[model samples]
Target: MKILIVSQFYYPENFVIYKIAETLQKFGHDVHVLTGRPNYGYGYILPEYKKIKEEEINGVRVHRVDLPARKRGRLSIIFNYLGFWYNSRKWVRKTKLKFDVVYSFQLSPVTILSAGNLYKKKHHVKHICHCVDLWPESVLVTNAVRKKSLTYKILYSWSKKLYRACDEILIGSPSYKEYFATTLQIMDKNIVFVPQPSLVENSRKIKTQNLGEGFNILYCGNIGTIQMIEMIPEAMKLVKNSLVKFHIIGMGPMSKKLVNKITELKLEDKVIYHGPLPSPKAAPYFKGANALFVSLKNEGIVGKTIPNKLVMSMAFTKPILAMLEGDGKRILTESKGGIFARQDVKFLARAIEKIAATPTSELKKLGELNQIYYAKHFSLETITRKIEKHLR
Candidate 1:
């Protein structure tokens, strides 16, 4: 099968689309990627990727479209989205190559999938939209736009059209099925639950890092408002044990605020910020940790979502210390992977203390169970096969 992946973010940006494309290629499918140039994180186009509009990397042919450099303001964001959307639509219309299936990675903004939708309509091919984030609801929760505003109404109507236009929809969270069915009036059978696959290989082992003699808890992902990473430092202050250390390894908008909070609380030693590390370098920190931490803000939309870090943490076989609810909590509880608490400083502190008191042997058993569950449900091979069946 010849598959074309339409995503705003892709390889060299450290997204799961790279893994999915590679796995598809390994499964004897011809995979092609259409994505924006590397301008994630700081938004500056990397030196190596500059001046090139298209290139082949690792046997996969990549078609890149120019996009505005990302910035913090709303104007900058809109420019980036509009630039990619316009260029990608133009490219898709002009390109002569045909595909058996058009897979759209609808991460956020949801408008990025418009190019794939056009192609699917023109070719009458199977179109699968993998929704990593729920739109309009996410925007509303983040206060990006008000629900009653005209902009929100337009976006809501646009989202409904996009979902209905697709031949099938792959939702990252199981909870989204009901939401789409009731809210968007989409059929439940057309919406399938396909959790994000873990990028780390189960066979890859990292040497544990020695960071003093304490129970190391690691949180390694985006440190943004949605992540609710501030809970870590606040919870650390309430923890009674002196040996528990929290290591945060990611960068986002809240990075400065988190740093200031750490200093304000005088938790320099108890809580350490390692900035952002590449996946290879970040693996050892996760491997060495006694437990992995994940959190989502107390928002209704956030509860129904599962962050990719949760699945990645399970791949390491480390007991999770999640401050989340809904699908995330359900996955943790069903896997017996680790303990969870609501988004409260006191509850998180108590949950940490409970994990601290549990015997290392018991924690090991929990980690093992998490690995078993992850292999069965969230492994790349399993997920790729499931996606393949749908593509065919």
Candidate 2:
């Protein structure tokens, strides 16, 4: 099968598409990516990639189109999206190549899937829309837009059209199935629950580092509004254990605010903020930590979402300290991986203390259980095979 993956973010930008494309190629499918030049995180295109370029990554083809260079701001982000949407639409219309199937990695600005839907109709092929974030609802919860606004209504209507056009819809969490079925009136038969695959390589060994003497709890990935990172410092103030250290290993819009809160709370000694690190560089922090942290703001929309960091932590055999409800908490409870706390300072403090008081042997056993569960459910091979079944 010749498959074309349409995604706004791809290789060299730290997304699952890189590994998914590689896995499809390994399974004897001809995989190609239709993506924009590397511009995420850095907010500018890389030096090597030209406005339009084609490259082969591990036998899979990648076609990158030009994207507008912009800083991190509302207007800048909108311009960037417009640039990709326009360029990708033009390229798709002009290209003579055909695909057996089209896969859309729906992240944000769901309009990107329009290009894939177009190609699916033109080529008469199967189209699969894999939604990582629920639109309109996510935007509303993050206060990006008001539910009564015209923009919000437009987004909602556009998303419904996209959902209806696809041959199959793959949601990252079971909770999302309920959202689409109940709210959007989409049929449950067309929606499949397929969680995101772990990025951690099975054979890769972490060069563990000595992270001093204490219960090091690591929180990785994006530190954004949805993360509710300020709660970490607030909870730290309530924790009595002086040795329980909170290590944050990422950067985002809330980075400065989190740093300020740490200082204000006089938690400078208890919390350490290590700026963003590449996935490989971040491994030691995960491996060295006694437990990993995952949280989201207590909102109805947030409950339906699962952070990719949680799945990666499980692959590393790190017990999770989750302050999340719904699908995320369900994963932790079902795997017997770690303890959960309500999204409150007191409960979070108690949860941390519980982990701190537990014996190292018991923590190791919990981590081992998480590892076994990850292998059975969230491993790359397992997820890839599940997706393959749908592709057939």
TM-score for each model: 0.95, 0.96
Model 2: per-residue lDDT, tens digit, 296-335? 7767756647778888989988788998877888888899
Error of 1 at 214 (Å): 1.0
For model 1, which pairs clash?
A: none
Q: What lDDT does candidate 1 reach at residue 361?
A: 97
Q: What is the lDDT of residue 107 in candidate 2?
A: 84
Q: Worst ten-residue run, lDDT, model 1? A: 201-210
How many times do residue backbones clash in model 1? Answer: 0
> What does the lDDT come to for candidate 2?
0.86
Q: Per model, how many backbone clashes are there? A: 0, 0
Query: What local lDDT score does residue 368 receive in model 1, on the 0 to 100 scale?
Result: 91
